[model samples]
Target chain A: MKTVIIKYNAGNVSSVSFALERIGINALISENAEEIKSADKIIFPGVGEAGSAMNYLRQNKLDEVIHSLTQPILGICLGMQLMCNYSEEGKTNCLGIFDQNVKLFPLSELKVPQVGWNTITDLKTNLFSGIIENEYQYLVHSYYVELSAYTIAQTNYGISFSSALNKNNFYGVQFHPERSGAAGQKILENFIKL
Target chain B: MLSKRIISCLDIKDGRTVKGVNFENIIDAGDPVELAIAYAQQGIDELVFLDITASNEKRKILVDLVSRISRQVNIPFTVGGGISSVEDVSVLLNSGADKVSINSAAVKDPGLLKKMAGQFGSQCIVVAIDTKFENNDWWVYINGGQINTGIKAVDWAKKITELGAGEILLTSMNNDGTKKGFAVNITKQISEAVNIPVIASGGAGTMQHFKEIFISGKADAALAASIFHYKEIEVLELKKYLKNNNLEIRI
Candidate 1:
C-alpha cells in the first residue's frame, strides 16, 4: 500500500517517515495535490503553532484537498488540531473536518504545555484494535480538541481531553505514535491496515 | 495524565560519545549511533546529541552521525552545540533531527531565537540555557558553561519564551555530573516562569532524583548523562518507579 505524508512548514516529518520505513513502508513526502490524493493512505504530521500552519495549508490549497480525501487520513499532533474547525492559538480557522474547536490548556497552577508520555483510556474505536485500553502514548501539545461525540480516546493532564477522534475516513491523534512505544506503534499499524 | 519523560544526553566529539562534568573531564562512552539505538530500545522518551567538537572537520562527521541515528531510532532527537544560524538549524533538521538547540549563539544574539522560530517554527527550535548559582541567584552561562552571561536565569527564560521558543532545556552547571540531585529550586523557578516545557538537566544520580525533579521541580522532562551512559538507571525501570510513586509515566 502507498502512503504519503503531507509536507508543510512543520517539524517531526522525518521521524514519522522513519517510523513508516520501519514498518516496511516507504512513504512519500509531498505537498502536491496530485501526489497526496493518489496515495492509498495519507498521514498529516506536524509540530508547530496552529495559525501559521493553517495559513500554509490554505495558501497552498492543501486544506481543501485534505478535506476531500476519501481514503483514510491520519492526523498527528498539530496536524490533528488543524483538522478541527478552529484553534485558540493565534485564532486559527482550520480545515473544519472534525467539527471541533482546539483550545489552549487553561493557565493554572499546573503546567501549560503538557509534554512527555501519557496513557490513553476510554478508547472506543478500531484504532485501539490490538492495544490495551490504558496504554501510554507519547504527546507534546499545548492546545487540545475538547471531547465530543467523535472522540475515540481520552487522556488526562490537568483535565481529560480528546486523545483520539474519528469521523469517517479522517482520523486524528493528539499523541505522536512514531515516538510512543509499542502501544503507539500498534495504533499506527491499525490505521495502516484500515 | 501526562507521564514525565526521561531523556539521556550524549555529547559527541569526533563521531564518538563522550561524557564529562561541566563540559570537562571528558571520557569516552561509545559510538554515537550505537548508544542512541541502545537508548531507544531502553524506552528513552527522547535523546539529545551535543556536538562538542569545535573543529570544522568534525562538523561534517556530526551531520553524518545524525543521519545514521535518525535512520536507526523512531524517537525524537534534539541536536546542539555550535548551532549559529537558520541554515544550521535547517541542515540538522533535514538530516533528521527533530529539534535544533541554540545556546551561546542565541545568547549572543537574542533575535536569532525569534528568527529561527519564524523560519522553522517554534517546535523545531529549542533554547538550551546553562545556569550556575552565584551570589544567591541563578545566572545564565554560555560557552559550554565557561562564561557567565550575568543575566538571571528566570528573566532569560521568560524572554526566550516570549520570543517564541517552543521549549527550554535548563542545565545546572554546578550540579552536572555531581549526581546529588537536580537543582530543584532553579528548575522550579524556571518551570513556574515559562509557558513552554522545561527540561531539567544535571545532578541526576539515582532514580529518586528523577522522582524529585518531577514532583518538586514540576518539570515536564528530566535529562541526564552519566547515570544513563553507565547503565545505572534504565529508562523503563525509571518509568516504572515513577508510576509506582503516583507520578504518571509511560510504561
Candidate 2:
C-alpha cells in the first residue's frame, strides 16, 4: 500500500516519515496535489501555529484537496486540530472535515500546553483496534478539541477532551503516535493496515 | 488525564554517554545508540542528549549520533549543548531531533531563539536554563554552570517564552546530583512565570522526588540524569508512584 504524508510549512513531517520507515513502509513526503491524491492512504502531520499553517494549505490549494481525499487520512497533533472546523490558537478556519471546533485549554488550575505522556481511555473506534482502552500516548498541545459525538478516545486535562476523532475516512489524534513508543507504534501500524 | 513524564538525560562526550555529578567526575555510561534503545524499551516519555564537548570536532559527532538515535528510537528526543544559530538548529532537527535546546547560546544571542522559532516553529525549540542559587535568587549560568549570566532565572524564562520558546528546561545547578529533590521554589517560580511548559531538572533520586516536583514545584515534567541512568529508579516504577500520589501518569 502507498502512503503519502502531506507536507507544508509545518514541523514533524520527517519524524512521521521516519516512523513509517521503521514499520518498513516508505512514505512519500509531498505537497503536490496529484501525489497526495494518488496515494492509497494519506497522512497529514503538522506541528506549528494554526493560522499560518492553514494559510499555507490554502495558498497551495491543499486545503481543498485534503477535504476531498476519499482514502483514509490520519492527522496528528496540530494536523488533527486543523482538520476540525475552527481553531482558537490563531482564530484559524480549518478544513472542516470534522464537526468539532478546536479551542484553547481553559485557563484554570491545570497547565496550558499539556505536555508529556497521558493514558487515553474510552477508546471507541477501529483506529484503536487491538490497542487497549487505556494505553499511554505522548501528547503536547496548547489547544484541544472538546468531546463530541465523533470522539473515539477521551482524556481529561483540567476537563475531558477528545484524544482521538473519527469521521468516515478522516481520522485524527491529539497525541503523537509516532513518538508514543510501542502503543503509539501499534496505532500507526493499525492505521496502515486500514 | 495527563501523564507525568520520565525523561533520561544523556550527557554526550565524544559521541558517548557520560554520567557525572554537578557536570564533573565524568564516567563512561555507554554508547548513545544502545542506551537510547534501552530507554525506548522502558517506555521513557522523552530523551535528552546534552553534548558535553564544546569543540567544533565534537559537534559533528553529536550530529551523527543524533541521526543514529533518531533512526533507532521511536520516541521524542531533544538535543542540547553548543547550539548557536538557526543553521545549527536546522541541522539537528533535520537529523531527526524532535527539539533543539538552546542554553548558553540563547543567553549570548537572545535573537537566535526567535530566529529558530520562526524557522522550525516554537514546538521544536526548547530553552534550557541552568540556574544557581545565590543571595536567595536563582541566577542563570552559562558554559555548563561555569559563568554566571547574572540574569534572574524567572525574568529570563519570561523573556525566552516571549521570544517564542515552546518549553523551558530549568536546571538547578546547586541541587543537581544531590538527590535531595527538585528545587521546588525555583521550579514553581519559573513554572508560574511562563505560560509554556516548564521541565524541572536536577535533584531527583527517588520516585517520591518526582511526585514532589509535580505537586510542590508544579513542573510539567521532571528530568533527571543519575536516577534513571544508574537504575536507581526505573521509569515504569516512577510512573506508578506518581499515579498513586494522585498525579496523572501513563502506566
Stretches of candidate 2 off by over 4 Å are B20-29
Q: What is the clash count of model 2? A: 1
Candidate 1 error regions (>4 Å): B19-29
Q: Candidate 1 clashing pairs?
A: A156-B1
TM-score versus the correct structure, for each prediction: 0.92, 0.92
Candidate 2, Cα interface RMSD: 1.8
User: Residue A168, candidate 1: how far off, in angstroms?
Assistant: 0.8
Judged by whole-model lDDT over C-alpha atoms, candidate 2 comes out at 0.86
| Per-model DockQ against the true two-chain complex | 0.53, 0.57
**Candidate 1 docking classification:** medium
lDDT of 2 by residue, A1-194 (tens): 88999989887887898888889989999999999999999999988889999999999999999988999999999999999999987788898989889988875565666777777989976788888877888887889999999899998787899999999999999999998888888899999988
